[model samples]
Target: MGERLYLYGIFPAPGPQHLALTGLDNQPIDSHTIEEFTFLFSAAKQERYLASRRNLLGHERVLEAAMQAGFQTLLPLQFGLTTEAWEPVQQELLVPNRDRLKQLFAKLQGRREVSIKVMWEPDQELETLMRENEALRLERDRLQGKQLRMEEVIGIGQAIEQAMEARKLDIIQALRTALNPLAAEVIENEPMTSAMIYNAAYLISWDEEIAFGEQVEALDAQFEERLRIRYNSFTAPYNFSYLAQP
Candidate 1:
């Protein structure tokens, strides 16, 4: 049996070009052109493409290299995507979806995905909330006198939780307000950590990349003491590409 093709992404056809890139197991990366689209892939054994950290990183590395090579408008395939051979990709993926692919290629041209994550210093925020909340102070005083009943303790905990949720929501909303105008599309992701107020990905045009960065820098300076804003602007359009998947 032949080795499966590990699909990385699809890019606009650049005629014939060399990608000085390697994929899983150090296999040389190659491309197949179908019409105006080029599919980036590498040959690999099924076992080598398992959902291991190494394989996942290999998939991202290939896409990253493609992006760095000036393929700004690209669609990244999900990790672990493989085919028995290249023929199926053409008959099933390319031929059937040619029109849609072309449309997406035009729509996504000169654009890239950017991710922004916002986090607040939990200790400082919590301290400030506790110090300012009158109800919380009363509750703390009630608990200080003697051994607290279960309901009393539960009430205090609930208050803190509610305050945290409200703060997180406000922070997320403010961030979206500051960033949405600069993006063609916005996708909100779940927070990966308790300290994370928001995690969002923005589809930004290459022409507006500088403007977007400047906006982020402004927000960072505005919230420097309380919230930390971190961003990455060169990633493949993974969030937007899923909508184009067959």
Candidate 2:
């Protein structure tokens, strides 16, 4: 078996068809005499096959299908990793990295990634801030009764800018407190922007989806009255079932 060529991923046992579809049609995974193991190989070398999109898709399909069948797969090699033969994969990479791989798989098993975002149109928020600023109201009232200088008009513009800044900070803080707990980790992608401010988050856990949905639903009920703040949650865009944790 040392001389035989293969690319291996440590997936939960009880599969052979998975191995077959993933590129192991000629070789049987069950035949390996190694303890608690399964492996797959087709005609091409393991490294060469992983380099193409079609092959990478095939690999992910195998792993995801296996996971759906109650098998937890620890994909050691990413889509583009290469190996000369099975021995090097087993003896060199897999052996030296055994503990790390096990820990990674342990963390990834039975878990999925969910992403959440809070976004609002900047114009909506800006309009809301303008309406809520008492200073603007007072300035308008004073200007209504008297002839205003250019400096007074400039001061009003500065006041609006200050009010907008304060409003942005307050809203961001409120959203952070409200949504951060519902996620395992929150990654702010766009931060606060002039067009649309957004907070992106990654939630990890099989159980978190429902809890997160519930939180979004509850927040919707509370913020719906305002009609300015909007929030949503969704699965991340990666095809991999488990997102590599940092």
Best-fitting candidate, scored by TM-score:
1
Off by over 4 Å in 1: 14-16, 45-48, 244-246
lDDT of 2 by residue, 57-125 (tens): 565565454455555444434554444456655686556655665565565565555544455565676
Distance from true location, Cα of 187 in model 2, Å: 4.3
TM-score on alpha carbons, each prediction: 0.87, 0.53
Clashing pairs in model 2, backbone N/Cα/C closer than 3 A: none
lDDT of 2: 0.54
TM-score of 1: 0.87
Query: lDDT values of the candidates?
Result: 0.82, 0.54
